[model samples]
Structure formats: structure tokens, C-alpha cells
Target: MTSGIPDSIMALVVKQDGYNPNPEGGIHFETMEPYLEFKEIAVPDLAAGQVLVGMAMAPINPSDLHFLKGEYGQPRRAGKPAGFEGVGTVIAAGEDPYAQSLIGTRVSFAATPDGTGTWATHAVAEAMLCIPQPDSVGDHDAAGFIVNPLTAAAMFEEAKAAGSPGIVLTAGASQVSKFIVALARDSGLDSICIVRRDVHNQVLTDLGATVILNQTEDDFAAELTSTMKERKPRFFIDAVADATSTQVFNAMGKDSTWMIYGSLSPETPPLPNTGELIFRNKVIKGFWLSPWLSGAALDEKLAVFAEVQARFSDGRWSTEVGATVKLDSAVETLVEALADPRGKVFIQP
Candidate 1:
């Protein structure tokens, strides 16, 4: 797979003829007919500033599922590759200066052009678009680290700036939540993690989270309220949004900054109380990775990446990827796990 596809290579392609953004069913609907096909096709030649990459590994992120179902973000054209994040090695480089610098290097890239993505074993990308993998990070960890770590890092800064006493993180057992909790601990702040099950408590508690509240437990709000009374966490990062969450958060003290990043809830996000804002100054906002990271320079982005990597190297930060799979199983693995309520799946492409 390191070598270029001489005649043909397999890829996941859109199967439908016409693109449909708002299909009858929502993004999670699995049509009996795959709009995309997994088949072998001839690989294209590299252009200037482009490099042929042998994809090493990629993670099955929530965004990947959304892209596949046509429910996340703006609707992309059908037949386009679905994955946006991955780590790959430069197998061939074009003549551009940046491309020349990337020869033989492995990197993690941002949004690649349509039809060129990490779902396949190979991709051709602009050399500058890739973030070189530091020598310290292994390929598996590096693959899962970039997108989630960066997002968590950004949210940490946001929470700090908002002047919250501590941060409340929902879906605290997920990979991204691990980074958020680790970052909060490093910053000398406490994190209150909200879990769906009691079993998830040990994971966050071992990671230094002070409070772990299982949403399924009875009178969870009373427990949360009691904890809030001790040391109020004015900042909340909800990777899971639902009506119950809205009610629980509404019960928080005023002047809190709540940022909703993911919608694990089947229902629409619950509306925030205007009274909290009108009288107490509570703020609720939404966050999407593409929009947030879109305009950042590679160097600037790498700085944050470097910091997070150092934390990992020092054994201060770590993510629990519950499962690992080979690159060939990318689609099937993702379809199953994205539907599951727990665990981070890593694809070693």
C-alpha cells in the first residue's frame, strides 16, 4: 500500500447519481442502497504542490458519520470521499517548495479536495496542507489525536477566557472528553464530567475529574446541584445535547458559558432559559470543528498540537481508544461504532 496503485486502487465512492442533502430520512438513515460504492479505481497522477500519501491510520469521528449520511454540516456532493481527518506518509512529491519539503514525511491534514480523502489507502494532497508528525508521537496515537485534541485545546482556551471556575464536560468518556479533562487538570482547574452510566465514572475519576454524575441515575440534578454549590463550574462543554441536559444546565448558577459541540441526543437541542441570561448572564453557544479550525494557519494549529503531544509524551494526557481496526474495515467499522453510544474506534489504515 505504500507504493502507488499501478493500475487501480479501491476507494469508497458515492453510489447515487443525483446529490440529495435532505433525504426523506435524517442523516442516520442507512438506505438499503449505498449512495457510494467501495470499489477499485485507477489512481490519478500528482500535480505540482501535491504529494501521494499512503494513508496509515484514521479515526471514525462523529463528523465522518454525518458526512456519510449527508446530515452534518453543509451538504457535500454525492460520490465524494467521506473522511476529513487522517495520517499519511508522502509516497511521492510534486515540484512545489512545500511539496519538496514533505517528501518522505508523514502528516495529518485538514480538509482535502473532493474525491481525495483518507477512507482509501492512498490520497494526493497539497504538501502545505499536511501537519508533519512529530518524532515522539506514534502513528496510531497521532491519527486519533489531531482533530479531537485541537478541538479540546481550543475549547480549553475558550473556557479559560470566559472565566469559569471549573468546566462541566458531557460525554466525558469519549476520546475528546479525555483531552478536555486532562487539559482542565493541567490548567489547575477541576472538571465535572457527566456520564450516562456509572461504569464510566472510574475512567473520568482516574483522569482527575472530581465529579462524575451518571445521567441515568435518579435525581441526577440534585447531585449535580449539590456539587455546583460546592465549587460552581460556570463553563459547560456539552458534547451531548438534549432536553434533559438543557434542564440540568438551566438549573446552574448565572454567568455561566455553555458551549454545545456535539448532538448525541436524538432530539433537537433544548432552548436555554432567557431568564438566566436576562437576569444572571448565562451564555450558550454552538461549536463546529470545520468552522472553528478552517481559517487557522498550519503553524499556529501545530503549536497547539505540539503542546498536546508533549502532554502525552510526559504521560500527562492520554485517550482511551476502546477499539482498533485495520484500514480495510473503515466503512463497516465506522457504521457500527458511530451508532454505538460509547467507545472511540481507531483505524490503522
Candidate 2:
């Protein structure tokens, strides 16, 4: 064990009834106070292949909210800490050689569904799950290593593998979408970015997006159809799933693939028109980073990780941090985080 490691640490615990039934009703910090509590808790012990991390920073992500609301694919136990990915320094390790080697090194890791998470002063994670951060990467960038960046790279690889001349992406101004634009440009592929507002048009255009369509505009459908027909984009990466997805699907060419990775709209998207699905052979599927990484070979995972790190180091890809909060202010911080969708909110635990 490391010399200064504590026996107990502060953590934000999520209760069984953490989720609010009506998200539109807004959070009542008083009544909903029972849902999450900040308190001192005993530090978890390291398992055979685990290492205890002294968490430096963790982000409040959309998935974290979904998990807290009990809407995520993976269920979380009540009374456990909440957080998905973070950057930390390894304080102690189990007897395994790899675990021991990680001791005292700063690394990034995603929380296991086994109760422990990064929203604590310390967390225990499988040693192999942690990736040592290079000195060129700062704590802020490394804290988000596992989610948006990796997903952007992976989705781009999928589009490339499909031999797509171009791709269509929803939520064009999102951090991940920006990464997609940059990566797609680097790979010599074209991208058509769909956003809800004209404010993001120039931002995405500057990012190398070949086509920028504002969904709020009157001619959005016509523009999308015209661009899709001309580009023949074989892949559609969607984040906002609603009627927008159906429109994109109708615009795509035959044999095009629609990959839904996030449900930002909180409503299930309507299925594509019957004729398009039946005769065009359009495909629809979901993409989650956990399953994608798990199914990947070790070399493939390493290559992607290396590419993500290099981009961060070179300043080619990054998410803007809108705010940072302490563990004790989790409730208030979460309220603020929910109100802002423009950038990431971080917890400096």
C-alpha cells in the first residue's frame, strides 16, 4: 500500500430511489436529497487483479445520469458510488505483476459495474482496465479518455470499414461529433453534420464537415435529402434519436447503415418508412463503447487507445470543460451540469 493512502474516503453515494420519475418536473434538491448522499466511507480493498486509485478528477457525463436514473443498460446497485471514467494516481495494487507496476502512476480508467466508481476519493479498478497516461496529456483530457473520444474513433473506423464515401452524423456540434469531423477529414472521408441550430453551422464547417444542415430550418429535409443523394453516405451515426432519425433514414441510400449510439432526445425514434426498409435493405443497430471494446482484440484496442492519446497530445481532439465541482457539492453541481449541454462538467474529487 502507498504511504499516505487513507483508511476512509469521501464519496457521492446513489440510493435505490435516486431517479426522479419526471425529468421535466425538475430536480427538487430537498426531496431528491435522499437519492444521493455525500459521506465518508471505508475504502474498498483491492482484488487479485485490482488496484486502488486516488482519483484526481471525474466527469459528469450523460451516461452517468442515465445510470443514476436507472435507465442505462447496466444496472447499478443502490448505495454505490456513481461515475464512469476518471483520471487518478494508483496508490496501491494487488500481488499481480501488472497491478504492482501501476502503483504510483497516473492512469485513466472506467468504473466497473460492481458497485465501485470514480466519484470517490479512492476507487478500486481492475489493473488491466487502467491505462497509464503519458506526460503530454493533462489530467483534464485524460479524465475523459474512455468515452466520447474513443467512441468517435471507433465509429469512424466502422464507417471506413463500410467503404463509405461519406457519413451522416446527428448532434453535429457535440464534442464527439467534432471529433468525428476531425477524424473523418484526416481519413479523407466526407461528413454531413446535422444540428438543431444555425449557430453551430460555422463551427462544424470549420471542423471540415462537408455538409452542415440545421434541422430547425424549413428546408432541412430537402437539404439533407439532396446531400445524402449526392454523397451517398453509407453510414449514419446518430445521437439524437427521434423523428430526426426517421428523416435521415429516408434520405440515406439503399444498404446504408444507421448506428444509434445515444438517445439524447429521451424519446424512441420512429422506424423508417416501410418501403425504404423493405426494398432498400437499410440496416439499423446500436453502438455502445463497452461491448465494442470488449469484443475487440487486444491489439485493436491498443491501437485505438494510442490513436486517442496521440490526438489529445496533439490538440486535435478535446472536450470543453464547462465547470468543475467538489464532492461535497454534487447535488448542486449536477443541477448545473444538467442545465448545460454545451460542454462537460467535471468533479475534482
- Winning model by lDDT: 2
Looking at model 1, the pairs that clash are: 14-36, 14-79, 15-35, 15-36
Against the unseen true structure, what C-alpha lDDT does each candidate score? 0.71, 0.83
Model 1 lDDT tens row, 1-349: 2243346556665554433545432336444136455667568776777777788877767666556656566665555555677787887776777787787888877546632767667776777667787767776566766678888888888898887878888887877787888788878888988887777777777788878888788888789889888878888898777776686678778888879887766577557777888898888888877766767677767788778778766667765555666555545554565456556666664
**How many angstroms is residue 294 displaced in model 1 relative to the true structure, after the best TM-score fit?**
3.0
lDDT, candidate 2, 73-164, per-residue tens: 67657767888889999988877899889998999999886427888898888899899999888888899999888899889899999999
What range of 10 consecutive residues in model 1 has the weakest lDDT sum? 24-33
Cα lDDT of model 1 overall? 0.71
